[model samples]
Target: MGGGDGGDDSVLHFVFVHGASHGAWCWYKLTTLLDAAGFKATSVDLTGAGINLTDSNTVVDFEHYNRPLFSLLSDLPPHHKIILVGHSIGGGSVTEALCKFTDKISMVVYLAADMVQPGSTSSPHDSTMAVGEEDIWEFTYGEGDDKPPTGMLMKEEFRRHYYYSQSPLEDPTLACKLLRPAPLRALNGADKLAPNPEAEKVPRVYIKTAKDNLFDPLRQDRVVEKWPPSQLYILEESDISWRRVITLLFSLSRLPYSLIFSVLYLFFNYNAKLHSWFDHISSLVHYIKKSYC
Candidate 1:
């Protein structure tokens, strides 16, 4: 990624949240593109997803996923503002984070996200079902299920239909390697996130994937209607070919490794600067925590 603009004093921080069955790796391509465009992008993994994966039993709630993001946001650069971009179910997490750290955020971009309304019992979209007839995957909800149930794994055949159907062509190996059982609690959490008037006043962008099987075009339109975005774009129409898709997916999958190595490099080569920054942020975090309490 390119360095911050030397002339402009204002620095932009982009925080990306991925959708269901996806990790931070999915934002790899977008991060690269944003970096080229002179913005700093950080693709985050929810508590139970991506590099944060631990025992499934431990990640059975929404707060579990939210805390990690909160911790990350708490330590951000004081001079920079954040732009949160959430895809699919990630929108909810972004919404929750925004509620807590509204002062730190500048904008929110929902890419085919689940637009939840306040006091709504169900999510706007049926997250369990696949999009088209070509894709057949059953999302089973147990009896008396209030929050989205956990422990459900996607069938291999269904995975082939939905994710790998478009890109990787007949190559299932890449898709299989990327697949993992997503935490159901994150999907079914009861916390309500309606359109905040304050948030609506800020800049919001929505990017719709035209060929998406999970989130249909009509559903996306409904989301846009309820939470009108400042800007919209169609990915497939915007020269986003199959090769590009593969490249993007590959990059998103590798973000954790990149972040790890980046931290290691900083620790070894710039330990003093990194420590100084951490100490500064620690004081800020303490102040913010006390004030909020």
Candidate 2:
């Protein structure tokens, strides 16, 4: 499943949404894999993230931060539909997009993300804040000493343990160099993720990381129970396992939304044999196509 034969040239696009303090750069590996499989993959940098020139301090609210995704969706061809994948707090932005452009989205996937209720007011950063003040670097740049912090970044010392403990050494190193300060106001703003009827109707798939340090397994379970997805797959690995998990997940694209449940359940059982699982899964896809597709 690392690379497709490029035999199917249909326009199946994947739009990846990165987590807080991260950028489009983080999705490099996954996007490359998707592209190899003859699929179109795009990763967007939220305002004040990635190479976007917007200053982090000036990002006033969640909506402001999500402008890039909205603009991309608005400009897409009417016949195109996308698979939106969100990681961590990017789930909020994904939800916002779902509410606004429900018709344009074919499916939504949340990977160890903040899959909160439609009108939840709690900040997605609440979990990070619980990690203790020492693990973060908060700043009030350009503001007086009396004002609240304008931006925040995970302290370099704690970044590895909290985010990349199970990842390769090089991934954490790249993150340290590229990670930027997340706008504090925007993350902690009063904006609510209010979902509409259309958004709720869209098929959703939630992927949980068993060893996720930032969003623990318990929290992931709670969110899933609150708003159950069309299908759920738990990776007995780290938050960074998208690189390995995405290959099999994308292969399931040929099956219609209703047919993904049983196939996904089988994927988790053979996840340990990830390297060779693709061939088996590819055969499974052929069978599904013959029987259901």
Candidate 3:
């Protein structure tokens, strides 16, 4: 059954966590889709990224770097449970958060990300350092010869090859403009993503990027082998950003998380002949709810 207005507003509240050198701004398209379909969505920018004022270098570990996300999770309404979606390095953040806040989370979705475990010693300090030509670390210009390290910013030049290689040519230009310096320790330091009972309690899903250059498909598969999720999805897109907005719509078809009629409305919000539409799609939700689960 739908919410009071026959809308899917409360079926699930989604919180999107972005990957390296990115921020909440990355989920623009997905938020538009969710808004149209009557779902609540939020994208979090970790410290030192997006509009946050924190210095990245000061963030010595994952806990401090991703404090914004954990804070958001902690502050959601007492009864509200979020479906956390982590992209790339953000997956590691999700892994850590689950240990402390599983009760507030309904599901976890890893989107072509580095799924780090508690004792992961080789997950790399950060993907931005290992992959691509930009070498975001190269942009480490001295704030002052005398000042201690605050954090390193990914230069506008390198973000394209490192992040938006698959997105629209212009998207990289725009996104890079908003990029901020991330702490070196976020990737290199110890962040206790150590497996916890709370984290194990929630259902999880993994989406593999078949043509991903950053994490690579093989490594993504290996992460899955290390700790399998409740469900797995594969995304095939040459331009990853271009594919990101639409992939969720396609991937969600099999989720059975929301009623089919609700989703049909997302596609055809057109008016007229409403009765026929209702007649055709109503039973599907019931059948799925009864037999599929």
Candidate 4:
């Protein structure tokens, strides 16, 4: 399903935030697709990720995660309107950003992302929360050395199970090289999301990745229910044919924006007109039959 408004805006700016154990590099395919589709897209690395990987001291809390986003928004071209997209735990940061900078954002897109309520902290095993697990993939920096500091590096096995399962086209060598240790404090830090009355007025789109093992579709639905979106979309992994998974992934790479806008359009204008009265009647009959059965 589609989510936001797709107008003839001069430039659609997409700010993508990756999930835990992931750096900005994760959005490479998405960025390419968005650019090709005529949208200007940039993926931001949280303080401890990608080019900013060495900025360990700067990445201790949620505030640290917001630093790069705040800087990017502050420096954006005066006329550009931004659509902030966050994946998994990054959703908390995106919501925080929207609360902090309501005027600069056109919409916020949560891609199977966390949609935590204000004044709430992500719960352990909440996949949406940033807590690090004791799995082999997460290796603390000081595990065997006296250099005690930062956190652990993810083991290849864990990464393979969670992150790379869908990246069949990615080179094995490059995927291994891109792996890095995430900050422990950042993972354990309590989320400090605040209520934003303004954000309520701002449009929101939530994309549910149906096959996500970490963020199961049912759990994702619960999160969405807590903070209902202007529009919701379910991108079923099963929908992607074996041969077309790559192409589907590439085509839907810019979906965070396209889907949002489409949903907005449907919600405001086309939804009522598109539904047939007969469909409702048929649904009622089916429901009644199921109830009796």
Candidate 5:
């Protein structure tokens, strides 16, 4: 997906937020693809992520972790709107934005991400998190020697099995090196998310990774069952691997500037049917970017 609009006067812009243990670097591949396709994309490093280097231990709440993105969004030109895409725990960040800046967002995309219900407790064994093959992985809470109620880090050995299992081409060694300890308290907070009265008015789309070991197909369904977005697109992980997953999500990158009501589902129903939709989406995005930029 083209993530940026290249400062095109009328083109669409995308703000990408990475998931837990992942920094803005995780978005490099997708952002590069988006750049080639002509969209202006920006990936933010929340506190303690990417190159930001905020100590994970100091992140006491979501506000600390979410400030970078929130500050970036605040700088956009008036009348400017964005398609906010969040992956994994990043979902909670975008969801919070949806409420605070309702009129500024065109759409909210949760990509195999957490859709946290404010003021609720979550359990892995609960129906919401139980949909996956979660048993295959082991998790450790807090940084080593750091007390309880801290960030969480997955075992490096299981990184490939859980995080990148759906993307077979992903080099676990490379991914492992980039992973950092996530501020668990930031992701698992007890504070209530600001209720967005306009949430239903804004279009929401969820793209599910079918074979996701971390968030199995059933787990994704549980998220959908809770939030019930405007539409759902399922990407089958059966023999598809990373290429297929990227292709499915890429379709969204190209539609940055389409009219919200007119373009919400332009690529939705057909994503599962067209294996090459990624190419076409890129072409369309280039055309749109060219026209506006």
Candidate 6:
């Protein structure tokens, strides 16, 4: 993904927000790819997530968990606007950012993420919805079992099936080792954001991971229908892991700027099909950025 627009225009910076139970570490491969292509990328570890050193149990609400992101946006250069990319529940963080820093963000990209609309209290696929009552993970925050869960960590046995069913074996292996307990209240119990017309003015893009087991594909369709994005692309048969779905997001260059479509299944219909499409998709890396920036 070589990302120069053939001119001296300001380089497009993509600020990546990872999903639940994840940290800045998850975006390692994507950040490297963007940097090599001449684009700037910063992946922030939300409070208690990644290596932020905050305790998840103490996180009281969404605002508290999202403090790091708010700080990062607050400190940006005045004229520089970033393309905010959120994956899974990270979409909630993106929405929070949109409400607070609409001007600093040029576009919001939701990758297999919760495109929670205004007035909605929680994500379409919150922790409870994603895991259900199955003994797939453990939830605790030092409080008694009677109280609501404050943090959660997925069980190793169920991790592969839910999050990385379609990804390479190594991807899930790495995630299983590195995944941390996410703050439950911070992710699911946020108060509804008051309507902000400015947030609507900013362009939004939703990239669906059709094969994602955690966030149902049908729910993704409903989200798109509810708040239609400027662009929508679906990664067929790809799981939530970047190893399988990152190429599809990186391949946005092939799409025409003026074309706003409902659904486009662009890559990896089956195993071994991704390489054939990569050559074409990677040919141009800054189509959307070049047009927008």
lDDT: which candidate is best? Answer: 2
lDDT of 6 by residue, 73-156 (tens): 898765454779888878888888999998888778888887776665545545324545677778885577788888888778
lDDT for 242 in candidate 4 is 26
Worst 10 residues of 4 by lDDT: 238-247
- The model with the greater lDDT, 2 or 6, is 2
The order of the candidates by lDDT, greatest first, is: 2, 6, 5, 3, 4, 1
Q: How good is model 1 by TM-score?
A: 0.68
What TM-score goes with each of the models? 0.68, 0.85, 0.75, 0.71, 0.75, 0.79
What lDDT score is found at residue 266 in candidate 1? 26
Root-mean-square deviation of Cα positions for candidate 1 versus the true structure, in angstroms: 13.5
Quickly count the clashes in candidate 3: 6
Counted clashes in each candidate structure:
4, 0, 6, 12, 10, 0
* CA deviation > 4 Å runs, candidate 3: 1-11, 124-129, 132-136, 139-158, 238-286, 289-293
Where in model 1 is the C-alpha error above 4 Å?
1-8, 36-38, 117-122, 125-149, 169-172, 238-293
What is the alpha-carbon lDDT for the whole of candidate 1?
Answer: 0.60
Write the number of the candidate with greater TM-score, choosing between 3 and 4.
3
- Tens-digit lDDT track of model 1 for 1-293: 12374454555677988776667877776677667545677998777677776644356677676677888899886656677878777887887787777778877777667655444455643642446555354344543457455644557776655554555554456545765556666556724565455655556666776766667777787777765666665555322323322223223321322222222222212222445644553454456445643
Which TM-score value belongs to model 4? 0.71
Runs off by more than 4 Å, candidate 2:
1-10, 132-134, 238-253, 258-283
- Candidate 4 structure quality by residue, lDDT tens digits, 1-293: 11123454345577998877577888887677556555578998887777774555335676775688788888876456687988877887787788878888888888878877666655522554322454554446544456545565557766665555655746445767865666666755535656668877788888787667567677888888777988887665422222222222223323444433553232222223324522443354356445643
lDDT of each: 0.60, 0.75, 0.65, 0.63, 0.66, 0.71
Instruction: Name the better of 3 and 5 by lDDT.
Output: 5
Model 5 TM-score is 0.75
Off by over 4 Å in 5: 1-8, 117-146, 168-170, 238-293
Give the winner by TM-score: 4 or 5. Answer: 5
